[model samples]
Target: NNFIPFYFFVDVYHEGLQYYVIRSIGGNLILLLPVGLLFPLLFKKLNNVKRILLTGFFISLFIELAQLSISVYIRSVYRSFDVDDLILNTLGTVIGYWLFFILSMFYKRVTYRFKSNTSINIE
Candidate 1:
């Protein structure tokens, strides 16, 4: 039910609820970090940042919608939908993608250097 993005951040800041801020923001961001790192590595088609972004957005949207559905079905607000979660989750995915990219680059550079150094000449 929290459609306003970053609203929780403002509320938590004003109320000095540091724990909620960390739990909500950090939890959402960390939730999808693995998705970003693994999707591209596992699927050749997801080897780009754009694909990661869209995938993250849709995944987060589905989670939020599911929560809303469960809350309605149970006649209780077990979890509320929040746009900020979508934003933060997507950001986390992008960050993960960048980390993967950097690591891949470093790996390639190291392997290439090792191969060149270990080249054997045929007589």
Candidate 2:
């Protein structure tokens, strides 16, 4: 009997995995946009892994808090204010980050192969 507001844009009863999919891609990018825009000037010296993981954790916390608070405003109050969302969203972000790493690795390898095959100096 969990309550989700009308304006949440996505259906809640579809299962928790729906939220994971939405948050994993759209939410991660939404949350990362500011960090990506700001990182060059704000914290150029920080390591990428630590920055992504730590900020992603905070972003997940923020999402959970937003959901909790907004649901309160609707006064339906049926959703459980559980910590599990925080865990799942943050892990989703981490998974997205890993996906980025894997794609980049493949891109580099493919580009190297293409460049070598064509006798083009990529350096």
Candidate 3:
């Protein structure tokens, strides 16, 4: 909490565009994708969009806060806590949820078709 928070997109605006894209934006998104995909799978209650999104937001917020804590208390600047990272991480989770939903639908359809074909009629 003692760490200074950047309210604006200073990192992306002032830093190298390529670095921001590759490390900050894309990295955070990719890093949190598994959290999004697995949360609903592991916990049925999170299958809903609102719950999943909230969980994602809290998880990212926790990570950012933890990073800030380490920097402030432990005297380490291993990471930078930024709100943009939080937003991007949440978006990544949403994308993963959609990916899981699409894959699940495809799996259900294929299994249903297979069962329909294999089941025998007791005529």
The full ranking of all candidates by TM-score, starting with the best, is 1, 3, 2
Candidate 3 lDDT score relative to the true structure: 0.79
What is candidate 2's local distance difference test score? 0.57
Q: Candidate 1 at residue 78, lDDT?
A: 95
In order, the Cα lDDT scores of the candidates are 0.90, 0.57, 0.79
Model 3 over residues 1-123: C-alpha lDDT tens digits? Answer: 223333344555566565655666678788788877888889999997788888889999999988888888978786767777788889899888888888889999999999999998898
Candidate 1: Cα lDDT at 75: 97
Worst 10 residues of 3 by lDDT: 1-10
Candidate 3 off by > 4 Å: 1-16, 121-123
Per-model TM-score on C-alpha atoms: 0.94, 0.54, 0.82
lDDT (Cα, tens digit) per residue for candidate 2, span 26-99: 65445444443344335655326566677767876676677778778888764544454555555655665566
Pairs with steric clashes in candidate 2: none
Per-model root-mean-square deviation over C-alphas = 1.1, 8.0, 3.1
- Higher-ranked by TM-score: 1 or 3: 1
Better TM-score candidate (1, 2): 1
Model 1 C-alpha lDDT per residue in residues 1-123, reported as the tens digit of each score: 889888879987889888888888888888898888889999989899999999999999999999999999999999988899989999889888888899899999999999999999999
